[model samples]
Target: VAAPARRGRALTAAVVVAALVLFAVGGGAGFALTRALAGASLLPPPSAGAPSLPAITDEAPARVTTASAATANGEQGAEFTIEVGADWTSFLEQRANRGLAPSTVVHLVAPTGGYEVSVQRFADYYPRHSVEDYLSLVRSRWPKGQYFGEATDVTDPLDPAAPEPPVQFSYRTVEKATELGRAADAGGRDLRRSRYSRVLPRGADLWVVEVVFPTEQEEMGRSRLFDTIAGTFAVVG
Candidate 1:
């Protein structure tokens, strides 16, 4: 159908950092690395910036959470601490859309480390598109990817075989994956239409944190509201 879905909005410097996150994603989205050298910029120029994932370390604003995996996702990885909002409940609740509960998930890989990609307005768009179609697109575009395969379309929820959350939802584990994430910065980026890209250092791995279900999730995708999630890399433990 379409190319593997990549988050273009991180179109900022989040490039290298986010691509690094994809390596762990072990799926099509991980291919964001192979797509860009300086990183891909989807928008026009002059005012555009580059890519930037959230923070991997901690800071003063939020108290450190003593991230379990420690540093980047790796065996015997370096560790870091992160502090989310002091009143996360009130903070998240305020940011979330009305009637929607704010959800903050931290997926940590054991021993080594894992990245956390949190989301708020989680929805089941799969009802219309279906994960089967999305997975097919993923494998077709990123045939070399480890997780992309021609599994049967998840049966519709009404079918007895479908899992809870229906054919639309799932999560990944903290695995050795470790792919690539970064941006290709053309001098003078255009915020309205820029895609980020970059190259990784030798031996470095990539990870990605994807957010979905915002009003503009389909049109804007991860790029829609990446700012709140982007700078978080160094904020958590």
Candidate 2:
């Protein structure tokens, strides 16, 4: 009877061990199956390295289009005409000076509110001032801590032989604290501005044509829209 009881106890212990082994094997197989169904893997992950990024390339030139004629007349009977996009609206305003000649400003607002071209005509204090001289003054008046690119001479495509070519320069600014920036923020848009300016002598007065637009729309500013304004601008008194 004692031998029989020992055999029974050994058999019971063996059955318990077999059951645990089966449960572990089944559980591991179930976990692997679940991972496979969920698009995961039990294998090691790929080694870390630099992230893949898109290649950079130069942007293609924008298409040229013929602009429509537009004119702005100031209160002092001075007027200027330029070619602008058909969708633009022109507003003329006279700015009075304390003891100097009054100036005229023509704001050409773009359709979508992100771009504007302003034409300003003011008395040239220095009658002999060159484009470079005017540009130096303009640079001095710019707000500090802004990024300004080199000024370049842009020949008038319509009048290539003109003696004084327009001086063109660009600058960038973040307008998060301004009124325009506040409106942009409400609309979930960034208000970082990219501005392009051309300064040239227009008879006794100086003409400064500036284009301001969102930085994301830089290609539009670089298009023939600017070319038409700078090349076809004419002023008369």
Candidate 3:
């Protein structure tokens, strides 16, 4: 009877040890898997650079600086310069970090009116499209009732002798007053006039400058002001 009792004790001990071994191995595997998943989750997301516009380099991000002088008020960018009225304020458009390229959009706003100018630059490698081609593509995306004026050839402010001349055009569109940040009755819309210019500098990129203001301000001499501002766009580097 004593021998049978000892055998039973040994068997119970063996079973307990086996259960502990299995639990340790399983728990260790689960812990490793959890850590692997956590490490993967900590990884950064893919770059937000536009697929159509590849980044040229991993250099420091580009920035815009306000340049004010008694004779001129303008914004200087990494590759371009644009003159604005003394009351105009400039800011770089916020965009996702693209390690290869700097921000390409800049905005200049008038001090006391709903007038704004935006400048955008695009690389030449990806699309390889001409300025006229880009303008045509843009016009196709305008909303209904858009009135487009005849496009006219304009001298490139940066390179006046470039083989391909820049183009300028004016257009009118109706937009929601709320969209333009103007106070209006419910469902009211406003007529907006805009001038767009496409300049192909003597480089691997092109620029587009747009000026927008309320149509009501045209008679107040805003049109000439907008044109003068847009014409001041030039490539610096």
Candidate with maximal lDDT: 2
lDDT of each: 0.31, 0.60, 0.57
In model 1, where do residues sit more than 4 Å from their true spots?
A: 1-64, 70-75, 81-83, 87-105, 108-202, 216-225, 235-237
Ranking by lDDT: 2, 3, 1
As for TM-score, the candidate ahead, 1 or 3, is: 3
Q: Looking at candidate 1, what is the lDDT of residue 56?
A: 32
lDDT of 3 by residue, 118-222 (tens): 776654412455666656656666765665553556654555654355666556666656667756654345655655554554444556677776655554433
| Model 2 residue 208 lDDT score | 74
Preferred candidate (lDDT higher): 1 or 3: 3
**Tens-digit lDDT string for candidate 2 (1-237):** 899999999999999999999999999999899999999989878765423322212242322232222224233424556666665677777766444445566788765666678877666433555566655655565466654554475544322443466667667775444444445334433356677777765444556778776666566666645654566666544
What is the TM-score (0 to 1) of candidate 2? Answer: 0.53
* Prediction RMSDs, each to the true structure: 27.9, 9.8, 19.3
The deviation in Å at residue 76 for candidate 1 is 2.7
Inter-residue clash pairs, candidate 2: none
Give per-residue CA lDDT, model 1, range 116-201, as digits (tens).
Answer: 23322122322343334333433343324233212232222222332232222322221121233223343333222111111111
lDDT of 3 at 227: 56
Q: What is the C-alpha local distance difference test score of candidate 3?
A: 0.57
Evaluate model 2: give its lDDT. Answer: 0.60
